[model samples]
Target: MPPFSLMRCGAYLIPLVNSPLAVAQTTHLPEIEVRGPRDSSIGSADSASEGAAERESFQSRPKLRPGDIVEAVPGVVATQHSGDGKANQYFLRGFNLDHGTDFAVTVDGMPVNMPTHGHGQGFADLNFLTPELVSGVRYRKGPYFADSGDFSLAGSASLDYLSALPAPIVDVSFGSHNFRRLLAAGSRTVADQTWLGAIELEGNDGPWQVPEQLRKANAVLRYSQGSSARGLSLTGMAYQSRWNSTDQVPQRLIDSGEISRFGSMNPTDGGRTRRLSLSGKWFDKGRDGETQISAYAMDYRFDLFSDFTYFLRNPVDGDQFEQTDRRRAFGAQGSRSMPNRIGGLDGLLSVGAQWRGDRIGEVGLYDTVARERLSTLRNDKVSQDLVSIYAQQFVNFSDHWRGYVGWRSDALRYDVQGRALAYGSLNSGKGHDAITSPKLGLAFTVTPQHELYLNAGGGFHSNDVRGATITIDPQSGLPAERVPALVKGRGAELGWRFQPNDDLTATVALWELGLDSELVYVGDAGSTEPGRASRRRGLEATLRWKVVSHWRLEADAALSRGRFRGEAPEGEGDHVDNAVERVFAAGVTYIGGPWTASLRLRYMGPRALDTLNTVRSRATALLNFGARYAVNEHLTLGLDVFNLAGRKGNDIEYFYASCTAGEVASGACGGGIDDRHVHPMEPRSARVSARWTF
Candidate 1:
């Protein structure tokens, strides 16, 4: 039978394959056929912190931006300080992963995090994501898996896109602040092959005093043949966006009535970016073994204008600067798995290898005013390459006991060519590094519905190539010490999973992670910053309960503490700046006939703003609401309300020194003024959308 569309029944959505309203009519519903993600059952999962979210979960949540889709992972929060066209800020565990550093993300077999980027190391931009095409998200915490390599120190998430859709769809939306969007998607089968395509267009003028004026376009085309057991696919994607941004501001400025909370110090602070990619994959599965391989190539460009200090660095130029990056990247990965018998026990062995290279034509930083460059600070052409190999063996010692051990090794090489005359020649160099990590996991099933797990692993994040080879500081033109090419980390987790019944599932985990060094390249400052060793320990809990036939509830909470490992310099303590200490989220959903509604609440606890632990930031909380109604078989409508309570809070905050024009003219800019800089969260707004299916 052809797949039928989803139907709302009470507080949940279920697919209707045979009959409409079949769930309401029967006490024992048909077996659910969720196909994309693997089940994280007692015997199948290695840790309690690992889980998967399917398309249904995505459909039920109310998201404010494309990157919000990753929030499906418990204890992860996605927020933004820049305009809609930029990557969302991600916070997970106890770490504020600025632009996805230490946390890896992927779609299909293509990596999303850009290493050694102009803005920051491991810069991940998901603005091109098309939510409707995502089939599932598989997330793992603590870097315990052998298949994951760079930027997996904190965690990793892999997203899978669907090869076909049940029906063609067209969607349109409009919202407060002149937000508008349109999407069209479809799939067709011919000659035993399926072809899928989608296009999206969006624009928004935010509530900021200076309009965001965001414009974005995205497209995807894919072709696939056969099933998961044996498949071949090719895909192409394109994305482009431009927008003006309201960066963080000093709270004192707002308190003194100098500017509104949602105002920008420099209206020209914004960015434009574009990406084009082509990828292909082939896989085969059989009783003897399984084999999979994939390859991808991309052309990317980025241009950004930002002013963080007003007039601190260059009082005459207003401290505004422009960053430009253009690169061509290519990568390929292949893996094979084989069934085995070890000591008369069932077992499996898997091995994989991956290779990636980036040819950066030019990555530069310059002094600028009103978005026009005045003088170059630094510019370089870079070539970086990486190769990784890993192997894992999984064995079932008994019906209740299972374990796995793995090992991985990675090698990296970098070459830099100077383009600018003043600071480029002295900083350009060549470097190479290598590292190996070991991983192990054990799981014990105490009962049919309960499981205990222990996991420990070593992981690492590569330092920016420029930082690893730097001989001079671009800003000050002084001799600089080069950092190690790779920084190592280790983590351990003890977890429990309890699933008493079909309607209830709960998980709790106690985890700790430590890094050998936190040294990294500071993109904003055009230099490298030294760091100390640090450690973080945390407890996380998640709960999901189906209260009744019409109502469902879910909640997640995390508490963590992070500190430097040893003594600190005078006037500074052990606190890790911007390390989040607490997080909580809860939601309720209601489904009745063709109607569905949901309400969600999120909280972020206060954090230290400086290493001294003297300055701290305030906690923040917000609420959101969403509802959908099926007008007919062909049309459906949706409503989403963000910041439902119109809360006045900040999306992000920092303690820093900056100087305004007035301060500079008055000679008060001496060393700048220390203050709290913040980016206010958006106020209450609503969006209405319509989707048509045929």
Candidate 2:
């Protein structure tokens, strides 16, 4: 039997099990251990937009929230609109991926994106993640990989956790705004098996007229044995959180001094959530092939109170609402890969299958007043099932040319049971949908230091089940048109990578993506909002240079244009709403002896708030600084400053109709007022931490 081998295939690790005699005929082999950070993906990546970041890279940056770790990916940004407990608003390329609509995230082989969620279609909350336990993050952009399926039209990310830590660690942190955190982690070996355990506790009172009293707790445990060639691991995780939310406020009110920038019209808006999961993975290497399998089960609960439009509907009761979701999910995935000859050329063939099912006990929306339910607008139970199969062929066509050709197919089923409503018997139905996607990638190695890549693929994102089978609108008993269960998309990219030496590397890419329809199912309203077909084209570039032995510089930038495909609607234009136009980020780090210091800056360009492009958001820039010093072999001190310049900006903005109490009392709220709703960015803050190792 040959030693186990693994290779990267998109966001997945393809197991290259067996080796030919020509390469494994050695009679004696010496044990080798590799260490140090992987600063570049010169020879391991197939496309310019695909890369992996080690724990050392992101752990050194200043993060305001746990989700900020994702920002380490070039051309990506993560911001918040509500409380810290909620999912972070993500933007990539030119799309505003609200709560991860077109992005897929996974941790330890367990999917994080919840389909048919209560708050959004694909809600992905990362508050449960503990950054210190992360081993690495692998990310890929575009739909040119068969290993990724739904919610991957824009990109996908997978975070891996360490099986064992070098030593026990305890950390304590304190910051402004009443922020505090404590974390502890350790690992022990017994009976040839390793046991790892970690726990975290955090709390914060955000800067708002109505403080966001956020409290959160998280824990993880794992047992593992064997090496990379053959291994088995079982992990369990638990998390719980609660907080008060200060959603976006009207800009007009702030400008008129009727309300402060951090003031909330509804102080009773907040949410509570909890999750428990058990997951296991196993892999084996054999003479003929290799096999990998993983399975997971999860229990989840959520309750949220929100008021996006304060008093727009009911003047006396206010426009507050509550959304609830309780569910259980189970999933399994497996893959097999083997070395095979294709047309007399060396090649590897891989096949994989995935299955997931979600049993939702109750997912509902209700009218509320001051955190109390006034009436049930919609209540239902749902069951969703997904099955996917994919195959890929990787071949070394020649000494300098290689590529992969792959295909994937997915099938979904939805079953909903609804309670009778005041208007009629609506929101109950069964539907099924299936789609097939093809992927192609070609790469040419011009020299040891340069490469060119071309890729194209087909992909799709599933819509909410409620929208697919809706017959009558719950709010107005009027007939409604059913939307497709799944929307299709296509993308292509041309990329180049240059790495003249070990100290410097650069990559550039031109990409385009198109969607059949931009329709979105609004979970808050329990209705589907219609939209026209759309297209996005963009250019992205990234560079990483080790200026000297102790200094490193990194930078990335993107420019994108998005528009509707055809003629505009009566009031809409060609411009895509909330489509980010430009993004630039740069960072420098110095690591020498016992001191490590870093400085980073990020710039986000203005975006259109509406289709007409008359309403736009202001561009903003933010800077952060961090430094750490090793006081001794057993202790370390660190400091981080966020919003170092104290610059004022908006984290998010939307143009919509909302009413105020004064306007309603004066009979001026005929149909509410159309204005810009903005969520201001957090003010300057600092945190200091001390860590002890044993």
Candidate 3:
């Protein structure tokens, strides 16, 4: 008889049973042994802290935003600093990440990070994602893989969507603060091809004096043929959102009872954004080996109005500023893998290439009040291009030992054209650079249930083109120093994975990373600042246990230290500001015939807020609970409770000097006085949902 196996599609694992004749013909074939959970042991050495999460893991979690889906990765934390329309703040391995500067994110093989973005470099916004279509998530927590390059110093994640669904589903939800949402998704097969479609509509009025009236619309369409390993697919997506914002407030104002914690300094603060994209992928498996190719094109627009200093810049206009970004981007990637034999030993060789480009029509900053632009501070057009090629070889020296070596080279070019504005002509220049990264990995199988691994690699992150050749600061008109087009990173890891039983899996890793230099473009100032080189070391541990047939438990913990590389002068400290030191997460999940429940706790530890360590941020802990009950074969009801403990904490905190109405004359208005700026966490909230499957 032919061999049979199980294939996972969405939340179902369907059995692929073979016919009697086929099974009888294949009975003489060699036996294949699949190891570890979901074949996670395939490349134990090539990646440290890398694995996949099942669909149930995502469906069971209580998430407020689509970006929260990334929190499924161990030791990864996602937070929000401003409006709901913006990208979530991401932190991993002691790096602040800052809108995805060090970490890379992708959805269905399409890159999510925007290079040279008006708000920040490598800005990654996940608002467009439809969580219901997600099939699985694959993540790696180090720069130990050759396939990932730019913005992957801290780690990388790839989210995949199901090509087909078992049935159509319609979900409607209502919650406190006037929150409402509706989603419809389904798939159909015709002429040996599968087509999938989804649409989502959401609206909310947050608990704030300004009432964050957020409205969003999202849609997706996909067509595919064959299986994931050898299939062709085309996907199109659209998303749009607009919302009012309640930005962080000064602690002095809140402490003096001048305003509430959820009060906004500028009621006009808000943003609008839209994205349209088309992507395609093709894969083939033949007698020789396997090959895969992908291509994508995208159009995006963003407009934001913000006021942080609240009268520090223009006392008359109240320090409100507007930022605008519009761009078109395209990219392509292809790879081929082939089996080989070396000295009577089995091995594999892979080669890949990628090319991407972005044409930004308008990236501008303007002084504004009440959403009206007063004057343009800077305006320019940017064109950026990147090309990379990589090769890797994996060899099996023996049954218990294996190793891999990889090399990658990347080339980048930047071109900027200034738009003459009232604030003087913006700097226009062109620059290009190239870098080569190498990776090495080794693994040893100690026993059937235990494995050890060691990995070392190099990675990099690109800088904004405006910061690479600017001669004058657009905000201050002072001489501005240019930074390197690409900053290099080096990292190493030692790890172990153990599966004592079918129900228990554990992993532990110790890693360290160093950077050549820390240079970032300050969006608020329209200039680049050079920071000291830094080093980070950390330890991460994770546990997954299926306690029973209907219950599971998961726990993860991470501790890290970050500091400047060189010695500091008198009165100076080596601490890295905003670098998180510790993070912990635990969750319990239950799945039965008609009832499901989940409870989760997340903790973020305190860290320094200033270069001198004189100021520090307070730790925060939050609890969330969710439950779902199936009413019938096609009906289900669900409820989620956020901030279950009703803890009073801040979502984010920073120490900086700002000016206010009463403190302008005391030498503490324009950068003299130091006070904490805080964005408090949202209080307890509840949401109820009903889903119907057809």
Candidate 4:
């Protein structure tokens, strides 16, 4: 997505949203005056969804994964996934920053929220996302109002699309993982109206192919009108994806002197996702101001993975456990605007309403030595509904100061009718619940070039923790546990943001966070009560600068400490999941018209793998380099050389071998033992690519 697409699309949407929302001639940044998606764009393509708010994000090539983009903001850190080839995760301010918190991620407004129990080591399909369809991307740090839900602990990333352009574009690239991709987009003007379309396909024969191969495609279609003085516009789209299931690795192979062996030796994905959306907006800016309404729907599924566990950790005998998931959802949101003043400066008021509904089902089955189906987990049903109302104000005090604040509340209700998980004495359980949530936020600039902010927020999660998945809880009577209720966290940040000019942007922040009701699985033995309290505090900082357009420099670093506030006799919060001591990122880029080059170095400090903290892990750093060059007006080329330093493992890596412990590693037997000290990771590799755009 280009930042300019929104400005272009907004050239027409502004009237429908309200003409008062449009940029006046007086605003200093003329290049981003168009109020579409982003508020600014630098060396990036003219089109970007950068927004008109104080937010944070990692930066990366559009063709790359979200993990590749974490360099955008300060304090955020991500590690490569080799042991668990799942979603890329970032440690937000020394705490666990998974799909649940730290930040919410979305593509073209589609939220990606999927998490498993116990460890934060799972991955989803966002890796398949391609940047070709993105027009703009918005990021927000801290609490956001009803518009974004209460899911963000560190922040949120919002992406926008621009389907309209004077010309058509197509991009194609190939590299490692048997990696290959094709992305194409185009726009057409008709009867004074414009329509846009995009299609993207990515496939890889991933290096760790213990039968692991991935292929995916995403398509989009949208339409808009010319400059709409009447303040009215409309857009719609559909998207779909299909891929192989996540492969778990076999522990024995590593102990047998094979650290980089594929476990299953034959893995496959049996899942797919499909979605569609349509929205309408009416901004009678021709009248008092602007009013807008938009809505969308999604349909998706996760096919059964028949005993892929043998791929991660082997049992004497191969067993297969697979399940299928079917899901559908729909929602809409509308906002109205009015003029105002803040600190005797220009300001705007916005009021909005939002609603959505969801339905899901899961089916399970067993696989035999001959790959025959056995039985299935009983069927299940779930329905959820959400409605919210919110208002916000954006104020520009002067060329040197700006302020923003907002409030929102929600009425939520949901129910589940299925064979709930069995926790020893607890069974035959089905449940229903409802909640009302409120959120608030504020940001102020101490100077035009620096800023400070504080926010308070609330939200809930209907974690679809299937009953069959068991994590032994710390209790005497209960053999297992069931997942229920939403997790909540609140925190504050004192930070400074400085943009000396378009050439550079930097930030530093110190923060403390509290998760009031989040769940954690811990204890020496299965016990009765829930987990104890937990706390996280940390410091984060980053700096980015464009040097003479021909050279760019960037660096980000984070330091933190976290732990269980109190020792629990039995229950969750026994230990921290994503606690880290330090993280750093440094990069440089050079642009020479048709050719652009970039190099990045990443580092992580040593960390503890267990709560005992008796043993610790090592630290590591790697260098990455890449380049993009134009072949012609419609063609371009790109390549990346990662882990150029060829480090064996990262900070989170830990492994045990025959030379170590006795019974514990032997798991009740006297056999030679190998304890997993830390998660395993992949080493240095290289990738290359090419593309064409019109």
Candidate 5:
């Protein structure tokens, strides 16, 4: 009776004592056992917290840039206050996602934020990303799913790249303030088609006292033919950068020593950027079920100079400011998925569409000093458009129940011209908005491993069609009030999941969100201000383990609370300013043989810098370390350590009002006064790397 069959290790199905003609006359076969996912309920919510740096569970993780790869997504928190070519400061759950509104970032399907942005309002910008050609990162947080639209209510991330590459590489790195880097990558397949290439160069001068000197460049090219779920692809990208900034400083000028603590109230504060892109993709999965298509184009540029109120409002050109952006973007998307039954219940159906456009010759705001430009507080020429459509359904009336429903619709258009500047007057505008988002999910499979979830959603974030059509106030011509170009959101979630074997897994969530106004688009006060209407609540937890067979461990934690939905003043206190209350992260990894190691820790808690919370911010922790060694087989060597205990934190903090240089004002000579405004943290750094393969 040596004829048996059934083998599928992961969700269990073992039983194969000998089959396939007794294992083709037996030469060896018998010994298999590797488990996980016995019933991880693949239906709704949770399960998509991924990362890969060539696997082994994140290859000794440690990243200093490339936006730190979204911090591997567990409660995300990336920060940087000035130049690193700008655009990092993220933080999640308790909001404060300023530069990227409520998250949503993508690569490969293109679109990385940037909606009517010149700086602030969904401005994503991962410095064009090279990160060794990524190759995996998928994240999800709130706003259920429905293909997530528009800055996705506090969640979203998708990055994938790597059509080929198993060898052919060169990498070099050196660090500690004078940092330097170079990378080159390759892949090839010739006639059968498959090519990929990459290039990158970087430089840094950091540890500031005025010496940021940044500078970077990157490039990539790709072409593919098939297989990756059936495919065709083409891609190209380029990036450039420059820097010099050390903004954010004033805790009474480092407590009156007048500057230090990585000082710089403006040191010609700086920025410069550029990006170019082209993309294309097509996919098909036969047996009557899947199809996908994508397209993209982009060219962008930005110039920035900031001085977060060093002298409060042009106290003789010291409140420096200048932000300029030029853009051209295009997009397209399509999708389809099928298999259905309805009445008899058994389903799956998906449909999608998306389109986007932006042609902004310039989105400006200036009033600078050492960097030129002396006035001109708003100058624009923007044209924006977006359209979306979606549908989703997934059901399985049994096997422990499952459900999902989705709908999405969005349309937005805005055209603005206005540019006469020197003193206001020269306007032209238009606006239109629409939104419909609905999503629901449910799952219940109480055994086999455990699962339970319920989610609800509706989301939106869009505003700044010149603040939905302003009429004046290009820096005070007065008479300005206009907002609402789509701003609505509501969310809820309750979840739990547990995988009891094959190396553990766990998750838990409880959430709530609401908003209808938080009116943004005040690029340094060029308009739009009127906010209040918010609510948020949260709790999240996660853990993953694989404590043997090479070891691994991870952890996540988050807690939140935000407010602002009614009264304040008298002693203030409605919180919601900078939200963010408690967050924690942990990591551990070790791979034997050729050796690899990792250790990480992060925490950022305590936030509230106004609304009479009497200023708060003091809880930031960091510890990082990484190691790699393999000096044989194609060579390799690596090391990274940052803040490993040098901890003297403060990566961000703000409370406003500035007057520096012996303040005492009644008007002019650096007026306006109130304290705190840090941005320290960076001392104990190291990096060293070398890799080669052919």
Candidate 6:
């Protein structure tokens, strides 16, 4: 029996057995200390032991890029290989991360959406955030807080820089994929005044065969003094990361989870940006109150080649693609928290308001073919402006319980010139839409060693007012128009936590979510239609224990099912690529004299190919192993290997498709017809890294 066949058999057989794999609690964990001072484990794979077991536990150190982040996360999927590592996209909450701009992204309280964007993921360039530089990542499913207003559909990713540390520090790393990393930060503390500065860089040829390459750099600086000094502070951060590749690779065959694709898929895509922020804080003594205000702005540009025609054999027949975009933003926020007795309960009230707007362009500046450029965006200039107001209050319902509620309203305006194309007398105009989002949660401690909780929240996203005119139905001959559709997200969860023994703790949670205006495939290049509400409901459970000194273990698993609610007719490209069935994770840690090691395993069920919407995966399980040694109190060495046991993992494919015809396109091609199958993951790649304290 071959490994793939065995895996297929286990997929069906394992469910029959309640106890598929035995897992114990954890006592000691591999401490891969991150930006924080404590030697705590970093990375999403090394989730913390708090909260819900598997479904929504706070995971740290998750991969930062689209491929690594979305691939490992549950309830999300992506398209596979495009030759030379080009055309990498993700199916997030069932939508393509393709255009880049649609899915909202933010870093340290700043938006990444561009001023103008088509109906895809091109504008949302998260590659700028290097995974290693990230101290921690918090992925909140469904609707989140108002501060994250830009994107709340597929949840959100919150990134933070190192906090509460000295002004100066340095870090460097070297790994597989021809990877190298460097970080340097300087800070000064003079009594009540403090100063900080830092720089970071990550470069790699990317070890994968796609022959892709990446380079990233970042800088940060801050200055602050005592409260009397205008209660003001200055902090700024900037980043630039680029991806270079040949484009798409076509897939042809698969066996034992490894795929063989022939033909070439080629293209090029990447982005760059700069951001800055300034804030003020004031504490009132007469009445207990804390307030903060912020002013911020960002300028970014993205360049891409999504035209698969680049590899159509005949240079004239190929579609050369490129979109140059620049986006800018300015905004302000004010909030006040006051301590008081609300209905005999001690709590606080917070409220604020803000306004923002952007000028965007979808210009087809240059392309290999002139006709393709004109057909793409000959007369494309769409801009949007928005203003909003919101308020939230936190209250203590009882000694062991707390709750919060919030509401917001928004107004919008849009501009465009149907010059390149045609529009019925529809002129640039303003529109208004508003919704009140609310959140409520409770925490209960039944006993000193046990706790229970529940939470429910709502969020909204109206379709882009700009994309309504990309391409009218090629079949209908009707004028192509992109209309903004109102979208909403709602979720509820119940959970419990228990500590039966000193060294063991466990968490169990049940959750369900609904998202409106889902992007359903409409069949055609750069085209899609909004579907009704989709439901994401599932169960998550985890068990962790420290059986004894020097030995620790943890187990976690999640089962989610997502689908269109009305049983709507399935189109050629209609599919749910989220982790519909199961995702399992387990880890073991061993600490010995002068040496420590840990082993981790992750199992993911199959998914549908985003493009053709076919269920094709054969199911896969990936194993990762890591070990480290202490050279002394001041230094340590370690080896970490992803895909241990040399298991060749398959590709889930990001949600978009495009091709290129660069010089390196020959070796990059794989599948024939859009090469649905991507090459398997590398057999086994390992990295040795270390750190020292002075």
Q: Which prediction has the highest TM-score against the true structure? A: 1
Rate residue 170 of model 6 by lDDT: 38
What's the TM-score of every candidate structure? Answer: 0.94, 0.93, 0.92, 0.76, 0.33, 0.74
Clashing pairs in 1: 10-591, 11-550, 11-591
Ranking of candidates on TM-score, top first: 1, 2, 3, 4, 6, 5
How does residue 240 of candidate 2 score in lDDT?
Answer: 93
- Each model's lDDT comes to 0.84, 0.84, 0.82, 0.51, 0.76, 0.50
Local accuracy of candidate 3 as per-residue lDDT tens digits, 292-354: 999999999999887777777665566788888999999999999999988999989999999
Overall local distance difference test of candidate 3: 0.82
Pairwise lDDT winner, candidates 1 and 4:
1
lDDT for model 4 comes to: 0.51
Per-residue alpha-carbon lDDT of candidate 6 for residues 1-694, written as tens digits (9 for 90 to 100) = 0112223333443332212111111122122223421211111111112222221111221232333543333333433433222334444433444433234545554555443454243244455443433344444554534444545555554454432232133345567777655555544444455555555666665544444456666666666565432345566767665655433333432332232332223323332334344433333333667666665666555554444434443333565455555555665666666776778887767667665666654533334343234343333455666666776666777655666666666666666544443332243344545556676655666666676767677776656554543445332356665556345677777767676565677767677777765655421233345556677777777667778887777776777667666655655433554333666777777777777777767676766655244545546677767676778875667676777777656644333343334322665533323434344554567666664432
Q: By TM-score, how accurate is candidate 6?
A: 0.74
- Better structure of 1 and 3 per lDDT: 1
Which digits, one per residue and each the tens of the lDDT, describe model 5 over residues 495-580? 77777774777778888888877643232342235487788898888787878888888889989888887876576678877778
Candidate 6, residue 145: lDDT? 47
For candidate 2, which ten residues in a row score worst on lDDT? 10-19
Residue 243 of model 6 has an lDDT of: 53
Candidate 2 overall lDDT versus native? 0.84
Candidate achieving higher TM-score, 1 or 4:
1
**Which sequence of candidate numbers ranks them by lDDT, best first?**
1, 2, 3, 5, 4, 6
How many pairs of residues collide in each model? 3, 0, 3, 51, 0, 58
Model 1 per-residue lDDT tens digits across residues 90-200 = 889888888888889998778999888887777889998998888888999997989989988888888888887666677788899988877777666554476778777
TM-score of 1: 0.94
Model 1 residue 462 CA deviation (Å) reads 1.2
